[model samples]
Target: MRGSEWVPGVQAAASYEARWLPKDVMAGLVLTTLLVPQGMAYAELAGLPAITGLYTSILCLVAYAIFGPSKVLVLGPDSALGPMIAAVVVPIVLADGDPGKAVALASVLALLVGLFMTVAAVAKLGFVADLLSHPTQLGYINGLAVTIFIGQLPKLFGFSVEGEGLFADVKGFVTGLGDTVPAALAIGGGGLAVILVLQRFLPKVPGILVAVVGAIGAVTLLSLDDVDVVGPLPQGFPPFTIPIVTLGELGMLAAAAVGITLVSVTDTISTASTFAARAGQEVRGNQEMAGIGAANLAAGLFQGFPVSTSGSRTAVAAASGAKTQVTGLVGAVAITLMLVLVPGLLKDMPQPMLAAVVIAASIGLLDIPGMVRLWKQRRIEFALATAAFFGVAVLGVLPGIAVAVALSVLNVFRRAWWPYRTVLAKPAGVDGYHDVAQYPDGAHIGGLVIFRFDAPLIFANARTFREEIRRLAQAGPKWIVIAAEPITDVDTTAADMLEELDEELNAKGISLVFAELKHPVKEKIDRYELTRTIDPAHFYPSLDDAVAAYGQRERDSA
Candidate 1:
């Protein structure tokens, strides 16, 4: 393997330009501002201590810089993964109520995810990222946004509410409404407004950093003793450790890990593609998987949880003039210094402010415009998205992911089982033959019927194809010419059906023929011994050729 394929950072460092240092350093310093608050908030969201988020941020940023292909992409604790982590860890930890156990389980989960992704990268299985289709992904994210927003409501209001799922959380929040703290509410609500307003109007500004700093100041100055704070963090860096769990628990963790890997891989690939396009670089998908896996593995070894690419943080870095991975290296160093020198720096930071950070991220995940666009363009895809949305929002995160994958597969099958079948006719002044249903006024040849089936001919659709051909035969045309361009592949069952159908039609003084059949599919027909009943001479390279041959035969007879 090429050195750049495995360790892209070394290649980048070897070719490092001196002029990029200042910009990278400045961007790194600016990124630190947003990273601190977001890391802590996402850690809490994952049902781990706030400090673990910092550990995750430091480790992932450093590790990705070494192994990642993208120069400016940032990796850290993500808002979307919070509920997924909590879903897996909370139930297992609640019984013991040991924070240590919770951290260990989360670390192990991270290890499993890292292992899965790394192996997939080695096997070049990056296409598994397509397991979640676009429409379903949009719905799943929308549902997750609702789940995260609802889950944080109690914390945002400066209280604790416990429930199992979305509805339970909603009920818990409503029941605990009177327990709201005014000071926490002010800080959370105000911070949310400030971040949203700045993001909308002044996107280049570090709005999250501003909100976090402002909240810290308000809490310290106003002496808001009533508001809950994160308290002082543990000092220094996390020591390398192996997270262990029971064998029985391993099965459950593995299941959740697979789901998390899917989400993480999808998120990373999409984000990498976007930034790579902007920078005029190619997306090395397998390398990207390896990079993400390395980051997760490093974090898991250091008592940190799973991490994914942060589009918002990457955008912040880019907007701040990031030119290389050195930017992330700088951010990691800054975070490590803060952990080592002053763990108490954010002791006065209000918990509500953290809630606001998460809520704002959740709001960004909504994608209502995409939903509306899908509905306008394709109702079937819109339905798939809706199913996926309800799967995540109503059923739960893990189950919702399952629903999303199932829906994508089933949708593909639905199209194959009953594909669009149409007849073609030559319209006036048109270059090619068009669908008869669409061009009803077009003229059809007296003795020829042109049929089109818009899907691959496979076992699932073989019967459907045969039935459609029979129906078209009712027109009593002397020749039936199939526009076979859309039929990209013909499976064994479909080839067999074609042989039988051609024999049946030939018995009725009619001939069956294929026009514009792909070379690959034609090879399959010959290999399947379909030439015995269906004449090889009946196949034409083009529809016009087939029609002209029929006219020539008629003229010869006259």
Candidate 2:
């Protein structure tokens, strides 16, 4: 068993309750229907043969059910990641156009992603997800949806052209508009319409599946063999094979691998957390990381690209009342049956219809309510959200992710490197110390300035800390008291600088006192023996004790 197997909030999944079997089976059927169309469409998105998406969907769910910590999360190929993978693979595939080479490269990318996730899990670095702030992710995903929706349009029109970026893709579409394959456009566009209509009224009726049957049947009746259909996909299980890559190729794939991995982790964590919350459960971050790692590992070994949790499939399971991870297993099994029994069912699936499948699914990923909540509740978050959204439009999805990461990192230092430093004094009704800004006009003892620092003392901000203290105490208080409760840590460089400050203050006949410091901090000061040079008598257990001691010392001197 893995170290995180006994994760809290996941015990419910392990409980073998026979009574929940009916609910689980019912949920399974619902998710199975939804997963079918999505798996195929996402395969196209990943720039692999449509069948590889089916393989990824089958194995990912099977592995996740056995290893995942969340009960409601359904593992499958995702719409959100489809275009991102396409953006990477399409260019490569178009360059070579070798089906074997394409499959090999995809498998390699999955392997690299799996290894990366496994390393992150072991290192407990799943928190690296924080690099993308919620605001930035919001913007990036929304922008990705736009790019994907547009990219699919050309395919729906049965016109194939190539481009590297969003604008270039639009240009290709315009240039190819004159040569639009009428048969391809008819099948893809008509299929898309059928799906949209069915989704509105017959959501549980496997609309995409229905559309596939109708489109293929119509094309067959019309004898339109000239139209570019998906063609006969292999009707068998995926054969185990390794992706071949040279060192030179690895460096190029790294960017794609890193981008896909980031998006995968982001999707997995968010979806798992959502489902866990629904189950009144807490997800094990490392366990979830390992589960996703295992899925990608399987994808790499077989012929597939990188994958993540499909929000739409998982939501279908939850909404259909899936009681446990059983639904994910069922979905995987259904995908296997499709491969073994009916691979040709999707050979004629219209490309535009496939695009519609993705577009419809992406509609749910909009996150309008969440963004609205932020708008009403916090302006800063709203600004971040908008910035990220626009950034994705201008900067592209991967770069937009980078933007989010940068903002999140800056936020951490923005407060720590320049924290609040307030002066305090005791009067009446109030306690030992209060912010001078909050309590002006209050009587002061006149000989002391007690300033509180709200963050740890470190080299990055020590100079700033000293400057604030100096400026605030220029009123010439005989004693400078540091209400050091908030500050619980310091680096060696900071400790040495404090000693210098102690010496400088002593020469000016001003006493520097420290109070309410955590025990660990006190130990460090003792380690440096800073107490030998400064007045040990100035240290106090509490702010009250320090203030009272100062009053007593003044009375004794008078």
Q: Number of the top candidate by lDDT? A: 1
Write candidate 2's Cα lDDT for 1-558 as tens digits.
554473422555557588878888888987776777778788887777778888887777776776677777887788877766666566676777665677777788888888888888888888877677776678677777777777777887877777666787788989889988788788777777777787787876667777777777877789877576777888888888877877777777777778788888887888878777877888788778887888888888888778788666777788888878887777777778778898787776666667767766666567777778888997777877777777666677667666767766776777789888887866578655788788886666778878899999998889988787677556777889899999989788788888888787777777889999899998888898888787778889898888889989899999
Kindly give the stretch of ten consecutive residues in candidate 1 with the minimal lDDT sum.
Answer: 1-10
Model 1 segments more than 4 A misplaced: none
Q: Candidate 1: count the clashes.
A: 0
CA lDDT of every candidate: 0.93, 0.77
Global Cα lDDT for candidate 1: 0.93
Q: How many pairs collide in each candidate, listed in order?
A: 0, 4
The parts of candidate 2 lying over 4 Å away from their true place are 1-18, 97-99, 170-228, 368-395, 425-432, 436-444
Candidate 1 lDDT tens digits, 497-540: 98889999999988998999999999998899999999889999
TM-score of each: 0.98, 0.87
